[model samples]
Target: MATNDKQPVDPVVRARRQRIRRKRARQSVVFGVLIAAMALAALGAVAIYNGAVSMPFARGFSSTVIPADDPIVPACLVEGKEKPIGYKKVRVRVYNASERRGLAATTAKSLEERGFTILATGNVKTGVQNAKIAYGAKGVGRAYTLAAQIPGVVLQYDARTNAQIDLTVGQGFDGLIPEDEVKLETGVPMNNLPGCQPLAELTPAPAPASAAPTEDATASS
Candidate 1:
């Protein structure tokens, strides 16, 4: 009796086997990606934890400080006119109710909180027992000046007498105010005061653009 030779597997059966192998391979790659993602997330959490615990002033620096007599006052208030040294168009003054300490850092924090970007900081000068600080703010081509006086004593008066802030916002001769309005105690209040608006908005006419030569124009001409 002749034995029947076994035929090769059918094409459909071979194709099915190949498909199953590919499916398993894809599953493995997906699983590996998920594991990597979880590990990265854990590492990020650890970094955040370390930063929060080790950071200085985690709660943020204080904006309020006791106001003292300003050192720049004598120079600025000369002849009863509060003339800024490097006068710009717009300026804003922020008052701290606490005596000055870490003033540069504090002023930076305060202005940033109020959505102002600091362009420059002036030098700090010594007073009887306090210090005077100056900084400038710029946004949308408009400039603002900020000046603060830090008192020597930290005492709380019956009313907030020592703490004062002056915000001046304007440009050129148009924004200039009278001598009395620029003073610490007598200057216009920031909230109810007029003319703190940005210069770009108030100015009606756009600056004229430079003329461009036409391509057809002769080189000699």
Candidate 2:
């Protein structure tokens, strides 16, 4: 016979244990709901924002926008366009191939006055019949820009060093166009590209052997 020394369980103790168990279960359920809600919110945020534009925090309203990796849109009022020829980057030399004295100096002076970096001015041994714009290596477009400076000029493709373009004044040379008439003839987006004009060969070819570009000017100076 075992001695039944253990008294009946206290009703108060049992009730307290039950209450604590119920409270613990409610707390677990609440914590699980909170975690699920947070996860869903994170997924929703990712799905909503894609690649329409960069992060909105990166810029501000009604303020000057910063440049980005890709070229800026024209509407952005930013100049991110790629130019085939940058005028300031190329070296230009003006040589007087014309019989007229001081034509080289005058041409060089004119160019210098109009934002051109003049190297040196001198005279050619044999004055050409038509003014020639000679370029070496990747100076064809620069040649075109040089050709544009003066009217009825020839383009000569020659291999030279240091000088990107040579302005050889010729017999037909009168003077640099009036400051108002210094428009460069360009059919393409950039002047460095080859158009229809055949490069300078001889005087009086009538038309260039290359593509014939409509004689349109690009600048006033």
Candidate 3:
């Protein structure tokens, strides 16, 4: 009689097979998580390229603290001539045909409050009834000279007319000419006038003295 030959089924071998299957399932879960992370990164990149998401970044078109339209007032009228005076300083030149006199002082307090300084004054003995006025700084002498050349704007004094000429410099000069006339010259240079003195250094007023202590109060103390 031939007994049926059969292979023995070991319990230890079956347990090892079950552990291997569980490890493969865990590996599959880890790989799926890695693939999901990569897809999310790609989606973010595509959204940025399509303008679906806004990235806040700095640009050159931003506004600044200082405005571009602001006006600048010069510190000194002429170089080497920065002298402070009371509000409204002007140079006055009084001329009586052949004889000329120059005086610089505070003409109008209102004008001084408005940031206007008189740099120089000249008196020419022409026969016209109205006096000629010229306004200029150290760098813009030619502009003032060109303005003086204009007819009617600069008048000659006449002896026959009993009227006196009153010429003023400052804000009035700015309005008499075009805006381009007030600019500095590029080609021809300007020569500063000689014997020019600062308004503060010319002649100053005396300062007041402090009040003296009372004799009665001193004795009581």
Candidate 4:
């Protein structure tokens, strides 16, 4: 008789309770998935930081296309070191080894006005007395050309294989000497200096030319 007194539960209330339970279950599932994704991301970042993994986007390109140690093609040395090369043909980089600021830039400007190609300008670590012209074995003539412009410039032969010249100005450096002071020969080949390397030795051997096509081969083509 006491159990019969309890009323039956409403169908509408039961359906509403079921819907709330389903919504809570879906929310919990979504939260768990988010936490798992965040944990994986954190692990990936740690791996990259420890150098255990490399990212493709982190690598960068090299500054230069050719390696510095690779051999370079020699310039035209038809006259060798004895004869002077034209100022326009000389490629130079001006470096200031003195305490004076902007010396390299000013010197480079002056050389540019004299028809010399200024490649770069910077400061050097070692100091010099007057100035030094550094050139490679194949750049002796080019160095001579630049030496004519700078007074009391010493020529230094290095291990480089190209024709580019480096002009390092020192504490005692002044502007280029007077044009009349430069001693150079315009035409006529001069005798090579004692113990000087010949052009044949300095220049690399030319590659053999390919055979020309025959008349019959051309006609067929």
lDDT of 3: 0.35
**Per-residue lDDT of 1-221 in model 2, one digit per residue for the tens?**
87879889899999999999999999999999999999987776676576543554665564733221222111100122223344565567666554566777777777777667776666655446556665653565555555556766656555454346667665566666776775643343433322333333312222223221122111111
Candidate 2 runs further than 4 Å off: 1-84, 161-163, 184-188, 191-221
Model 3 misplacement above 4 A: 1-8, 55-221
lDDT of 1 by residue, 1-221 (tens): 99889999999999999999999999999999999999987887787787743444455476644344422311112122333323333333322222233333345445555444443332222232332222212111121123322222111111111212222111110112233444334343322112233322232222213112112112211
Best by TM-score: 4
lDDT of 1 at 121: 31
Higher-ranked by TM-score: 1 or 4:
4
- CA lDDT scores, all candidates in order: 0.34, 0.55, 0.35, 0.67
Select the stronger candidate by TM-score from 1 and 3.
Answer: 3
Q: Which candidate, 2 or 4, would have the higher lDDT against the true structure?
A: 4
- Model 2 poorest 10 in a row by lDDT: 69-78
TM-score per model over all chains: 0.25, 0.45, 0.26, 0.49
- The numbered model that scores best in lDDT is 4
lDDT, residue 24, model 3: 97
Residue 193 displacement (Å), model 2:
8.6
Model 1, position 210: C-alpha lDDT score: 19
Cα error, residue 138 of model 2, in Å, equals 1.6
